[model samples]
Target: MAWRNALTKSMQELRIHLCQTSPASAGVRDFVMANYAEIKKVDPRFPVSLRECAGAEAKLTARYDFGVEKTVSVQGASSAAVLTQLQELIQLGEKMPKSGE
Candidate 1:
């Protein structure tokens, strides 16, 4: 039963981490999505969408002309890491070269 005890302990730790971080991650997701909508205004040709995944994971998709698209996702163990990943995606979108540029 020693292995069983170890497994249970590991699962408990995982649960604790998720409980502590998930709410903050959700907040970050909302913040990023709101900011992304503003970014889309600058170039409506490239639209963005946000997806919430199980656990503390978030996905952002940027669709380009001609049905081309790219997705950026972050499954962070901490709130700060999630925020950083979201910010990086925004910065990258801002730097994306326009067509024929």
Candidate 2:
């Protein structure tokens, strides 16, 4: 019972956080979408516009845009490289930082 209550509370907090953060993220999505033409020339598979990107981001979180930006920022790099870097960051997030020497 306690665990279930804790889980419910955690989920509620997450929902609130999402609601607060989503608007800023939506703005970012709009900015990215406005630049889609330039971004698409860099990567053909990029979404067609900002609304699409925002929808995806809403489902996936800001990390999706971070990955896309990281992927596109490098010249002559494949999308796979961006995915690889994102994966590394995700893994790093799962681990604890080392103590000071």
Candidate 3:
């Protein structure tokens, strides 16, 4: 919810890919558990997707318009670190206009 305004603009989707039981995904898992609800609450129309697999890498993908996407590896990252990255992406969204804006 740090930059919730981004959700109403060019932030198309927020995808979190992580392994269900991998140690590297622990932080992401914890983050989803604690803050995912709040994130959706901030922007009810924003799309937040979670994908869990046995051996998937832990990553966060923020998709914007014009097929633009920003991805960051969250492998072994702390929940706070993930949140910081997301806030940065939101800030980026504010500056990156959508196609034909």
Which candidate number maximizes lDDT? 3
On residues 31-99, what C-alpha lDDT tens digit does candidate 3 reach at each position? 899987887787887889999999999998999887789998999998988888888887787788777
How many clashing pairs does model 2 include?
A: 0
Which regions of candidate 2 are displaced past 4 Å?
A: 1-75, 97-101
lDDT of 1 at 97: 51
Cα lDDT over the full model 1: 0.40
- Give me candidate 2's TM-score against the actual structure: 0.24
Greater lDDT among 2 and 3 belongs to: 3
User: How do the residues 1-101 of candidate 2 rate in per-residue lDDT, one tens digit apiece?
Assistant: 23222222221111101112354344333433453355445445433322233223332221221132111121222334333433443443334232221
Count of clashing residue pairs in every prediction: 0, 0, 0
Please list the residue runs of candidate 3 whose C-alpha ends up more than 4 Å from where it truly belongs after superposition: 7-10
Cα lDDT, all candidates: 0.40, 0.30, 0.84
**Cα lDDT of model 1 by residue, 1-101, tens digit:** 23222222211111111222365455455555455455445445432333344564444444433344455554442445554544454444445554544
